[model samples]
Target: MSKKILVWFRNDLRLHDNEMLVEAIAKSDEILPVYCFDPRQFELTNYHSIKTGAKRAQFLVESVAALRQSLQSYGGDILILNGKPEELLPALVSEHEIAEVYHHREVASEETAISTQIEDLLWKQKVNLKHFIGHTLYNKEDLPFPIKDIPDVFTQFKKKTERDAIVKPCFLTPDAISFVTVQDWGILPELSELVVNEDIEGLSQDSEFKGGEEEALNHLHDFLHTGEGMALANASLKKNEIVSKLSPWLALGCLSPREVYWKMKEAEANYGLKPYFNQIVLGLLWRDYYRFMFKKYRNTFFKPEGFKQELALVPLADSELLHSWKTGNTGHLLVDAMMQELNATGYINTAARQLVATYLVYELKVNWVMGAAYFEEKLIDYCPASNWGNWATVAGVGNDQRLTSSFDFQKQLKIVDPKGAYAQAARA
Candidate 1:
């Protein structure tokens, strides 16, 4: 009997450095590529905001569309479906007589729960569910400490990991994937189909960023080596100019962290490890730190009071305040401008994110989870670990060692966006 495998595309969307896809191609005689648009993700959040807002939904659509085209070019086609994975996978397994299922392991609580459910369903059918770590820069096993032993503070984790850990080389992209026949290649849903309020004015479609493996690789090349490199190198010295806008592609898994790391190393070699270059590497380290922290603390990372923290009696989740912040009508110029940028483009620099989040949590006294959820909906670059963990920290509920923390909005504006270039552009 011929062996067949179902390669489930989750957050790890690209063909390059996709360990699970590479492994499946090696082990199976035929491959069934599948991507499911989970309805649950499109539903409204507790804060009365769509869990996946227009900007993100549109980006996801573009990403998946790009994935489908790439797969087609390789003699394989992705079965893009609009349904729950647990419901869809079993049917695909039985119909195709799939010997096994292969996918990247997700670390967040909800994602892990869904994976567990699918594993259980697949087990009853006697099909093996294989998982690989594809999201992080360093493999979990390569880390010096176990997940439980990952430090509470990022500095400690970064120091230890940077000193000892190794980032494994990325898996090679398969030259060709053996295609399996399927009658229905489900239609890829548009923003109108997935989101109810699709006609959101000012929610511009022509974002500076476009999603896909092609765009990602191109951006990586230009940012690291070309004229774009000179621009970034020049901008790195200034606080106002962002060094790279690679987070959206990173969040969608269109670009792997390892790929980015290796490219940065090459740039460092050519340009002699500038502080700005190191800063980019530090950002990637911070990403790894958050994922490891998420792995250790699990669902507690999302709670108002995070792990090892005392539960507070303070009422979090003030809906009215949250709405004001989300809509960019907070009456604070910088905060409102930042919020507007986020709402319109689904892209904001790290500094702007911190400013608005601090304003919402500290100044307005709104619930941090509300702010996080709003970002989850709005941010094109939203990763569960980075988004929630950062929110918890800012809310005085997560990994911060400080007793209290808040960003001064005026001070921040003066330092980062002085003369209001960013604010003015955002408002316009």
Candidate 2:
């Protein structure tokens, strides 16, 4: 009998630098790759937003299609399905006579719950489930301290980790994958099927951030080689032009953080690019910090009050205010423009994100979670930890809680949207 195993695809969607996929290929004679479009992701949240908005849904659809294409090129195919993984995998195992399951472990509670459910179900069949950590820039084992002892402050974490830790080299894409043939390979879900809003066609035209590893690698290469990558190191550039627009790919695991880190270092060494690339690395560090914080804090950031007790207060539930903020009708020119861009493009600049989050929490007095929830629905790059963790920080209740006064939005307005160009473009 052949050793058959199932490689479960979650957020880590790419063929290159994928540890779980490589491991599965090495361990089994025949392997099946599976992706589940969990219905829960598309359902309405308590905050009254679709769990997955149309723009994000469309991106995901394209990403999965790209993954399937990559797999086919490697003499394998991904088993795409649009249901819960726990319910789908057992049947797959039984039908395929699979021997084991492999997947990258996740930190968020809902994802953890689903993994736990699948593990228990697989165990009932006397099959083993293997978990790998592939998402963070620094692996958990390589961290200077255990997750529990990681500093609650961002600066401390950054200093200690950079000094003491190292990133593991990314795994190369496999030479060939021997696939176990299966009937009924599933179809990718339509954007309308995955989102609540009936009108999705009009917004599907923006090519600003198409999904896939190909786009990700291409963007990184061009950005690092072109004037945009060098100017920040050598000359001053406008804010919008400075952004690489790689977050959406990073969020969906189409681009590995490790790959980004290595490629940036290579670009610096070979081209003598200025230390400005370190700023990009710093952003990746913040992303890793948030994920590790999620493992340590364990659902505190998602609480109605937050991780701190004394900071507790009743959140404002004004529908009109929340709607105003969500729909870009808040009357603040810069913030309204930012929200409008996010709604249309599934993205906005980092500074704009911070400004809008602060506006939602301080000026509108709406619940911070509501704003985070909306981001979760809309951001093409919405990683659970990064989105929620940043919001909690702005709201004064994150792992790295700020001790300063609320942002002077009007002061920031001049700095982030200087001369109103970003605002004007957004409105146009």
Candidate 3:
């Protein structure tokens, strides 16, 4: 008899170049795909907003639906459940007699805790739990320096890995697996049910950032195979649109970095490499480096005293200033506009993020952790390590040598958007 396996889908949402999915297929003839909405993610935090807001929830629902459709074409169907994994997975394993569970590894504190607990639970049930790193182009075990010994500065980390680390090739899965009996469950929660206080402007945007494996794959084809590659690369370097707007998908695991990296290599070999390729890949390195830092430093990443005591002067929180910044009402049009864009779409460009954080910490003297928590609630691309690590860096708390740095809004607007195309779009 073919072995029954549960392939638990977390953030790694896509089917392409997905190591966990590939391993599950190689091991079992019949695979039951599972995705849990994970109730804790939907609940409100001390920040007084949802941990995962409506915009992100809408994207997730769309992505999960797309993943299910794709899996169905392969003789497997995605089982959707809403609850804690600790309670749900045990019931699922018993119900399906699942012999093994396969998933990608997560590095955040909460996610790591869940992974460890799940590993122990599956062990008790005698079902093998398998994990593979899917979010990074370069895995931790493949890095030159030991993860614990990873440098405390981005430049140092980047310098070491730029020369030393090699991106491993991604795994691919065949089109189909044999049919398996999945205990029929009903409809996954729609965007309306999953989100409360849906009346905000963020929910009504005409700009669509829908989820799913096919959409992400199509985006890849459009970005690389089309003429937009040079444009995006240029935009990314200048903190504009020339870059691949794939980070949200990457963050949510709708697309794997390995798939993107290989595609870049193929394009470079064909058309000659662009300067943008190296810079964008450096962005990916920052992602991996922060994840390693999080594992090494733990919850300290979220605090103002990140990975060290006596962080250079702790900035006081100015509630009035923060509220203005959050609502996009700050007098500075660039900073306010960026905040407005984020509030409306739950996503923002990397450059805009740094500028806004710089204004908050150095200009307004807002508490760093408060800003990080607000981002956690709002950003669709919110990865704990990247988000927290980045916030700490801008606030002079994380792995930077500088005592502090502040952004000059007027100077950036002139340099990055002299004609104010982005600002004009924000108004529109």
Q: Using lDDT, give the best candidate's number.
A: 2
Q: Candidate 2 — which residues are off by over 4 angstroms?
A: 233-241, 316-318, 403-406, 418-420, 423-428
Alpha-carbon shift of residue 192 in model 2 (angstroms): 1.9
RMSD of each: 2.2, 1.8, 2.9
Pick out the ten consecutive residues of candidate 1 with the lowest summed lDDT.
233-242
Better model by lDDT: candidate 2 vs candidate 3 = 2
Tens digits of per-residue lDDT for model 1, 1-428: 88999999988889999989888999989999999999999897766667898889888888999999999998768999989999999998999899999988888998999999999999999998998988888889999999988888777888999899988887888897898898888889867788855565556667778889998999988877776566555554442354589899999899999999888888888876466576777889889988888888789877776754556534655467778898899887778887887888998888888888888877887767778988999999989999998877767777755624446656656766778787687566
Which residue pairs collide in model 3, if any?
A: 13-253, 63-212, 231-242, 232-242, 232-243, 233-242, 235-240, 235-242
Which ten contiguous residues of candidate 2 have the minimum total lDDT?
399-408
Itemize residue pairs with steric clashes in candidate 2. Answer: none
Per-prediction TM-score: 0.94, 0.96, 0.91
1-428 per-residue lDDT for model 2 (tens digits):
99998999989889889999898889899999999999999898888687899889889988989999998888768898988899999999999999999999999999999999989999999999899999999999999999999999898999999999998899998998999998777888777778786378687565768888898889888888876886765667643447778889988899999999889898888766645567788889999999999999889989767777886575546489899999999998778888988988899878889899888888878888899999999998998999998888888787665533546667567768768887787666
How accurate locally is residue 418 in candidate 3, as Cα lDDT from 0 to 100? 80
Q: Alpha-carbon error at 235 in model 2, in Å?
A: 2.0
